[model samples]
Target: MSQLERADRILDTAQDLLLRWGYRRVTIDEIAKRAGVGKGTVYLHWRTRDELFLAVGAREAVAMIEAVAAAMRADPAEIALHAYMRRFFLEAMRRPVLRALFTRDTDTLDRFLSSPARQPLQGAKLLASREYLGALADHGLLREDLRPEDLDYSLPTIAFGFFAIEPLLPKELALGLEEKADQLADVLRRTYGPARPPSPARLAAAAPEVVEIFERLAREYGAVAYGTTKGGDPEHGS
Candidate 1:
């Protein structure tokens, strides 16, 4: 297989293993075996097991960003602040890795999520998410008065808190995730979004730049995840 195809196989295998067995139970050898490649071949893409799993996480982030971007392309209105947030939560429900990241369940694979080796990948994803929100504000899709830092802090804190804390509530009172997501979206849509939606022209104008911001982040993080850049691999000389 071509290197890119082989790398994708390794990551696909690693992600499946991660979801089936938490990070601690997963190993490079098993991932390689599942991908029908040798251990050395796995290392050819990722220098360590940590790097390999980080790549899986990176893949998940890229997939979500691409999904959002695709929606924006199809309907510029998808760039509107509330629409974006609503779609994000819906997408998160569909992607197990994203739900894991948002939940940050310490009892599960939280160790790998919090590991030092994953920082760059994590930072890139955060930067992209934050920057995209900032872009929305810049383009009149969100409240212009809102500070970027506040926008960055509040949205995730609110959405993740709902997911993290919802389980603690009485089971009888708990709503389905799609229902919860809609409620969350309504709350955020009223608070963070503009009093009135932006014009279609404004959203269309901003879509290209918003997509570029995320694409750039994906490339930078993908390089590190695949050990393609200098100092990208923690196990190797950096």
Candidate 2:
């Protein structure tokens, strides 16, 4: 393989190991072994595992930014809105990997989410996200009083809950990640423009809708879904 391909191969392997094993359990040797490269080969790409893993996350982040932008091109307001949010939530579910990193590896998810580095990416995406919402707003797609920033925060924040809390709850309690995600997006759409109070049954029905969005995101974004191969849910969501 070419040097770039070799480097990318190493990154994919390393990310998987990190997800499955956490930072502490993962090792350079394992990544090299998984990548079909020698240990020295791994170092040529990055000096430390921290650097390698962080690079993996950075690449994923760039892809997701593009993915959300792409989702905006789809048709029908609610469907397109769902698609856009699926992209965001899918990325958010990956809080363990790309979304919030140092926090998981070093015990800092909340701290990192609240950090400054998130500001610009958060702000830039908001402009397009808000603009997209403006289109939805015009179509009478949303609830009629919500702000674009809610698009910036809500569903993803709930996804943050999945990444931070799911592993903690038993499988039954975890329910459906994507289902909950879609339901939340629906709420965001209706609530975004206006706060339409959903009845309990309506809220329940939205579950699978959210799950579909989550599944779509996982398929498109790959490893962004909190990358825990096992039970590595985030702290109980605030």
In candidate 1, position 132 carries an lDDT of 85
Residue-wise C-alpha lDDT for candidate 2, range 110-158, written one tens digit per residue: 3333444344334444544456555555544556565555556674565
Q: In model 2, which runs have C-alpha deviations exceeding 4 angstroms?
A: 33-48, 59-83, 90-159, 170-174, 194-238
- TM-score of every candidate: 0.84, 0.53
Kindly give the stretch of ten consecutive residues in candidate 1 with the minimal lDDT sum. Answer: 229-238
Candidate 2 residue-wise lDDT at 206: 38
